[model samples]
Target: MNEQISLSAIKNGNINAFEELFRSLYPPLCGYALKILNDSDLAEEIVQEVFYQLWKKKEDLLITSSLNSYLYKAVYNRSLHLVEHKQVENKYANHVLNDNSEIYSIQDAMQAGEIYQIYKKTLSQLPHRCRKIFQMNRDFGLKYNEIAIKLSISVKTVEADMGKALKAFRHSLAEYK
Candidate 1:
């Protein structure tokens, strides 16, 4: 297909033209992306996303260069962005793992254990419904509305129980603060 004619037809919302462009370019684009990304699945995904964006923005599409060059550039840019993102994630993970070793001492572990014991004791002293509400919110990560629905109580009741539980814990753990 002539590059200019196909681009024109694509701009005019011709699905056949778009499909033809996609079918012809997809493999080469994926191959180009794979050279940068080093992952077949991610390369395919990048190419697909580029095509999707092209189709989605077809009405405003403008090609100042060859369509092949444009598609290759898009795939290349996206692949590099993904690689940079992964590098950032890996750096963050490494920083956390390396930094935490120095930050936490044996004394910190002992203090944490003592705090946990105090927490458990304080929790046990709470009224049955208040303890349940507090556990639902904290341990189970349930929202107030979810806890209220599960316990067949009003949101106000859940709030009151949580407040009471928090007060008991604060009073019990005051020495640590």
Candidate 2:
């Protein structure tokens, strides 16, 4: 069937047309996502999510380009977003871990304890509101908007406080780096 005809059928709630399109495109889309994400399960999940969204929004769906190009672009963008999110998570984990060596000795334990002490000292030195904002984000895992709402402040204030807290930590811990 022609691409436009298939899309029209899909828009008109034709299940068979949508199934045919999915069957033809699913494998290639999964493969494309896998190449970007390097995880088979996550790639499949991303492709499935794309298709789900496509179907759910069929009534309002608008494709200015070819369907193939549109699907490929969606998969590509989602894969990249997942990769970026994972990188940020890994970066934060590594920063907290400090040393990733497999061997754990008494001296290493002592060093870690000392580092924790320094970190607490630095945290304490922050202005009261800044310290609370930092704790709300890092300790409580609250988002900036949530923190702002809880404190009756603006999101910008939360962001600025977090920036100040991080800057202080970086300055205080420069020697460790």
Candidate 3:
């Protein structure tokens, strides 16, 4: 199948070899991704990211078997990771909604206040940057780009801090529930 030729050429830093491989596998990869993810757009994203990673990691990449299995496994694992992360976010969002609903009752309101107070207290214990970023997101309603610009940090950093903030919130608020 000349698989060794392609892999060897790519290992020697042949751009043409990588491009050829990408073009040849693009359709089947997207089709496989679609079968796994059930969404055309997501499938395209997964396939694209898979190829990009292959290119980025070309130097240390060692494929003892067919490259197809390696690529397929990488895409599958990435999709599963994405799904698991979404599930966690959804679970926490549902919990926050439930807490908000319970705040309607008078007795629950006092209990909720205590819960919120405890949450605020714990939040204050976070590093200054983390606290500021969390407040900007929850209290100021700023997007990641805005927060990044305001704090002179990268957008990726802002996104990361928001993730950390959510994790901390979930941990601290667990005491209430």
Cα lDDT of model 2 by residue, 1-177, tens digit: 688999999999999999988876777677666655667888899999999999999999999986767777787667667766664233333422343233222333334434555787899899999999999999999999999999999999999999999899998888774
What is candidate 2's local distance difference test score? 0.77
Model 3 Cα shift for residue 78 (angstroms): 1.5
Q: Tell me the spans in candidate 3 whose CA falls farther than 4 Å from its real position.
A: 87-177
Tens-place lDDT per residue, model 1, 7-80, is 88998999999998887667667766665556788889989999999999988978898776777667766766
> How would you order the candidates by TM-score, starting with the best?
2, 1, 3
Question: How many residue pairs of model 3 clash at the backbone?
Answer: 0
Leading candidate by lDDT = 2
At residue 41, give the lDDT of candidate 1. Answer: 84
Error of 1 at 129 (Å): 79
**Residue 78, candidate 1: alpha-carbon lDDT:** 75
1 or 3, greater by lDDT: 1
Candidate 1 regions with alpha-carbon error over 4 angstroms? 87-177
* lDDT (tens digit, per residue) of candidate 3 on 8-39: 88878899988877776666666654544456
Off by over 4 Å in 2: 87-177
